[model samples]
Target: MTEILVVGASIAGQTLAYWLARHGMRATLVERAPRLRTGGNGVDLRDEATEVAARMGILPRVRAAAADVRGMKFVDAADRAVARVNMSRNGEIEIMRGDLVGLLHEVAEPEVEYVFGDSVRSMEEDAGGVTVSFEGGTTRRFDLVVGADGLHSSVRRLAFGPEEGALRHMGHYFAFANADSALGEDRWVTMYNLPGKMAGLYRSGNHAQAKAYFIFRSAPLAHDHRDAEQHRTLLKEAFGHETSWRVRELLDGALADPDFYFDALSQVHLPSWSSGRVALVGDAAYCASPASGAGAELAVVGAYRLAEELAGTSDHQIAFRRYEEGHRELVKRKQQIGPNVRMMVPKTHLGMWARNGLALSMGLLARSS
Candidate 1:
């Protein structure tokens, strides 16, 4: 029997465990959080990943967990609709990130060992296997170690190197937090764009609380990703010039939110996803920067493919190479975010007006269909 240690019990880690179990290999999972994480904004499922979910026997549960959000209504500062972008336009379903994670956890639990509230401190590899040290004071050896963790992955840092130059910051920032549902319409996401900034509220028929969003364009600023107060202050400074469309109210909600998630819009672009007895998966290897709308897909599909390759061989190095070769092209395409950034936060007021026109056209097409 081959033993493997998977880090980060996120979408990627859960899917990886499920597929690895099916492939006749079970693994232990470690998460930094005290328990399962249940706080996050909306996420989508699409592409080949849809099939992966079905094969895992969780597609129905995923469909049932849909947020039931109709679409996004781009609004002006006066709280009037300018145009709408239909959610169902892409033939994909949107589920809350937490809900999806939970579903994956539920399905993968019995077949896996879970270590919560702790994380990897350091790792050392040898001819026999890789030995990992945990922050909680323990060491373990395994035939393979996979970092299914997110962008700031400890395994990637230990196995590969620092992430300073590997990350491509998209010259923008975005944040999301719980909001008062009454502030937004049921089943709709209300968005307001002004020049280089965007503010929005997402309300779903199934959720009692809506989610608030704020995005702005700027060069990289010095800040800690883990500091919520610092993030709120920076957001205030960035949106200081805007007095439009509930910016004040959204900011207030964000500050009050205990689960606020704020970060620079960035993608991870690494030269390779593997080294020696360790390898990386999902955002740790190739994050599409959230703007690509492919995080969930990439995470699941990449894990599934890695399991497929590893199942056929004892040579994990070759399996890692095969996984990279199989998934690298799509990763490259998804990391191209210039057009996505321009669409996300227009550089000028005139550009926003143009965006409004484009939205209206898309809405019209949806209606006609």
Candidate 2:
């Protein structure tokens, strides 16, 4: 059996390991978090990703746990819905990120060795295999190493060099945390915008708890990505003074939540997904950004494809090249992202009015049709 090391145990890493083992390869997954990071915003699964989930026998579970969000409603300060954009598409299923992660874990845990609360510290690659040093002070060797880690991947830095050249800031930062369910209508994502910022509440009919999310336009700010306190401070500075449209209540609740997620709206644009015996998958190599709504889809399909390629060949180089070649077109299309940012956070009052008007027109057209 070929030995493989997969970094990060979220959707991508778990899916990769599961597929790898199914193909008669041995996989060990390492996660920096002590446990699974299941708290996150809703993610969508469509097209090839949905097919992949079906093959894994988790499609029914995913559908059952679907967020069931009807669509997005743009609201005013007085809490009246101005326009609603129906986000439901025929072939897509939306589920809370945490729920999906848990489901993936249930399927992957049996066949894969998991190392939580530790991470890869360094790696030395040679003709035989790659020697890995873990943060928990252990050394191991694997025929191949893959970084399914998120955008700020340690393996990418270790193998492909620093991320500065590959990371593209999308002119904004966003945060997501728990919120009071009563703040928004059930089964709807309610959003309010002020110039270049948006504060929203996502209320799923299947979930008792709600999620508060905020996005603000900004140039990149220098800060430690792992510092929770710094994330809170930055969030406060961005929306602390806003007294409109339930912003204060949402902010308060978000700050109180321990698992607040804050990150720059960024994408990874790597020239190559692999270096030597090391390779990258999912957000570690090509993040389309949240605005694209393709993170989960890309993660699932990319991980599966990577594993499939590796299983088909003994040559890691050939496998890595084939994986990238097969997946790059989808990544390229999703990375376009287009006007999603502008639509979410209009830069001016006139722009907001125009957006609202367009949405209202679309809603009316759909109703008449």
Candidate 3:
């Protein structure tokens, strides 16, 4: 039996483990967090991602836990609806990130041994197996390793190189957090946009708390990605000057809430997804950025395909190559996030007005069709 080590307990990591265990391989999964994280913004399941969920027999569960948001509605600073995206017509489901991860965990955790509150400290590969030292003061040996961690993958850093050379900033930054339910609109996503900035309030009918989303176009800013307090401070500074409707209200809640997520809208574009006995999948390999709205889709489907390649042969090298070849094109296609960024946060006043006009046109077209 080939022992495998998988990093991250993210949707990608959990799904990869599920597939591997389904194929009779029990991989060990490690998450640096002490427990499974809960409460994140909603994510979408589209195209093959929906199929992947169905094949796993977890699609129903996902739908049950879905945000079931009506659609993403763009609003002007005065709080009037400008445009509403027609997600209902797409036949896709939008579930909260935490819900999807939990569903994947239920399917995976029983079959695969999981270790939380610890992480890989160092990894060295030899002919027999790869030696891994853990931060929790333990060592393990595995035949192969896979990094399904998110954009800031520790496995990728240890196996490939530092992140500075790998991460490509997509000229934006985003933040989100849980907010007071009083500000929420039931089953709707209300987004407000200003020049190069956006703020939104999301409330799923199934949940009590609303989610606050904020995004701004910036060159880049200095901050520790892991520091929640720093993230909160940065977000406060980013939104402090905005006099728009509910912007200050949302920011107040976000600053007080510790569950804030702040990061650059960036992508990982690596030359290869593998080095010797180690390889990467999902965002660790190719993040299409959140602007594409395909993160969950790509992560789940990519992990499924990578597991398929691994099962095709006992050799990890061939599996890695095949996985890369099969998945890179999709990454390339999704990473071309052109108008999506502008749609979210237009760069100039004219651009912003044009986006509103286009959204009105799209809404009109949707209603007509």
Candidate 4:
């Protein structure tokens, strides 16, 4: 029986634990957060990830919790709809990030051990196994340690070295939170954009609340992601005084929401996602940036492939190589879409106008087709 330690009980970590447990392997999942986090922005299941979800036996649950977003309305500063992209229920399904994580966690809990409010403090891996020290002053030895933690992965830092090829900032920042959907605009996402700035509201089927998303271009603000005060202040400075339609109201609601999430739009690029008996998965290894709109898809598919590869071989080295090989192309395609940030958060007046025009044209073409 191989004792595998998976850091971060996020979607990736949970999915990996579930698959490994199904393969008759015992895994211990550790999360720094006290418990499962809830109320995150909606994430989409697209491409091969949809099949992966079905195979995991959670596709129905995911679809049931899916946001009833009919389409997206792109608007100008004046709140007039410039374009609308009608989303068809074809190959894509959108669910709240929290819901997806909860589903994965539930599937993994009975089979795997879970430790909350703890994290890896240090790790040393050898041919025999990996010795891990936790921040709670506990030590454990496992046959393998996986860093499924997010972009700022402590496991990556401890096992792979400092943040040399770890992260690349994509020249933008995004923030989102749940709020009251008093607008009565159910089954639709409304978006307003200006030069280097974007504001949107999303309605989910599971709740009457709407989610507010704010994004802006910045030259990498000096603030810690974990600092709530700094994150709030950054968002306030970015769009605090903007006169866009209901922007003030949305920001006020966001500031009041205790569950607000703010982070830089960044990508993770690693030369190698593993060393010795330790390896990394998902965003910890290669985040394609939120601009790509494939984070959830990548996380689910990457975890599946990684666990499948590990099950195929007894040697961690071979498994890690195979996982990377299977996943590199997907990661590359997602990263290639990172530059689409300009379309989402245009930096100039002309860029904003062009984006609006292009979206309008696309919407017209879609209607015609």
Candidate 5:
């Protein structure tokens, strides 16, 4: 039995573990969090990823957990709808990120061993196997080690090298948290865009709770990613004075929420995703950035193809190469859309007006088609 150690129990890690175990490989998944993280904003299953989900026999569950959003409305500071785009016909299904993660965990638990509240501190690969030391002061050996950890992957840093690749910051940062649905809206996402800033609210179809998103353009702030207090202060300092509808209230609610996630909107560009017996997947390898709206899709499909390649080949070298070759085109296509962030998050009043006009025109064209 080939023993595999997978770092980061996010969607990618869980999915990869499931496939690997099904292929007669033993996989142990480790997550830094003590339990499954929940209450994230909705993410879409689009393109080839939909087929991948169906093959995994989770399409029905995924569809059942979808946000059921009919459309998204762009609103002005005064809360008037400037444009609306019907999302039902977008050929994609959206589900809360936490719900999808939970579903994947449920399916993977029976087949894979899980270690929570622990992380890989160091790794050493030898001729026979890879030895990994955990932060909890324990060492283990595995036939292979996989880094499914998100963009700031500890496995990548320990195995590949200190992040040599460029982390292209998209001149913005985003934060999301669960909050009270005081906006009294459902079945639609409301968005407000200002100069180099954006605020939005999304109400879940299955729960009365809502998710709030905030973005602003600024130099990268120096703070620990795990520090929620610093994250709250940064958000407040950035948008505390803004007069957008219920902005202060939402900020207060977000800071008070225990599960707030804050990070820069950035893409991880790497020359290669693998360095020997260790490899990377999902955002750890090629994050097209959340602005591209393809992270979840890429994660699911990439994990599937990666596990398939590994199962088909005995040589890790050949398997990693084939995985990169098979998936690089999709990564390139997704990264090509990075330049569109300016249009998506306009930086001036005139730019916002232009964006609103373009969106309205597109909405009209979509309706006609």
Candidate 6:
């Protein structure tokens, strides 16, 4: 049996481990967090992702926990609805990120060895295998090492290079945190924009809790990505004084939530997903940005393809090349974020008005058709 070390127990890592275990391989997963990270915004599952979930026997559970968001409505300062876009589509289900992660963990737990509260400190790849050093001062060797860690992947830095060389900034920063369900209309995502900033509330009828979303246009700022305090301060500075459209209440809720997530709107673009015996999957390799609405989909499909290739071949090089070749087109298509960010956070009042008008027309056309 091949012993594989998978860093990060999130969507990509867990899915990869699960598939590897099913292929009769031994997988050990290490996560920096003490436990599974079950908090994040809603993620969509569609196309190949939905098929992957069904193969794992978790599709029914995912459907049952679907967020069931109807559409997004743009509102003005007085909380008047300016325009609404019906996001309802066939064959796609949106589930809270935490719920999906939990479901993935449940199915993957039985066959995989999990190491929580620890992470890979360093790794050295040789002809036979890779030797890994953990943050807890432990050392181990595995036949293969995989980095399913997110954008700031330590494994990537250790194997390929630093993040500054790969992360492409998308001219914005975004945050997501728990919110009071009462502040939002059930089954709708309500957003308010002020110039280049946007504050939104997402409420899912299937879930009792709501999620607050904040996005603002900015160049890259200096801050430790891992520092929670810095994240809080940056978010506060961006929207702390805003007094329109329940912005104050939303900010308070976001600040109060313990699992608040803040990060630059960036995508990972690596020339290669593998270096020697180590390979990367998901956001660690090709993050299409949350704006693309394909993070989960890509994670699922990419991880599946990677594990499938590894299981089929003895040469890690061939497997890695096949995985990259198979998935690059999808990544390329999704990376072209186009006008998503601009539409969500219009730069001026005229742009906002134009966006609203376009959204209204889209809604009308959908109804008419």
TM-score of each: 0.95, 0.98, 0.95, 0.95, 0.95, 0.98
Local accuracy of candidate 4 as per-residue lDDT tens digits, 187-229? 8788788788988899866767789998899887788878998
Off by over 4 Å in 5: 164-166, 338-340, 362-369
Candidate 3 similarity to native, TM-score: 0.95
| Candidate 4: stretches off by over 4 Å | 362-369
Tens digits of per-residue lDDT, candidate 5, 1-369, equal: 889998989878888999999889999999999987765788878978888888778899999888887777777677777677676756698888888899898889999999999999888889998999999999999999999999888888887777545477778899998877877368878778878888888876776788888888887768787788899899988889987677777788888888898989888888888988999999998888778878898899899988999999888889899999999999999877744667657999999888767766665413212
Say which candidate scores most in lDDT: 2
lDDT of 1 by residue, 1-369 (tens): 788899999999999988888788868999998998888888878878888999999999988888898877777777877666766747587889999999999899999999999999999889999898999999998999999889888888888888785788888999989998878989998878877888889997778979998888989899987788899889889875667778888888788888888899889988889999898999988989878888888899999999999998899889999999999987787677557668757889899877767756665413222
The C-alpha RMSD in Å for every predicted model, in order, reads 2.1, 1.7, 2.1, 2.1, 2.2, 1.8
Displacement of residue 170 (Cα, Å) in model 1 is 0.4
- Write candidate 6's Cα lDDT for 87-197 as tens digits: 888999999988999999999999999999999998987899999999999999999999999989999999988899999999999999999999899999999999999
For candidate 2, the per-residue lDDT at 152 reads 93
Winner of 2 and 3 under TM-score: 2
Please, what are the lDDT tens digits per residue for candidate 2 over residues 44-124?
999999999999999999999999998888888998877777887999999999999999999999999999999999999
Clashing pairs in 6: none
In model 4, the clashing pairs are none
Model 5 is weakest, by summed lDDT over 10 consecutive residues, at: 360-369
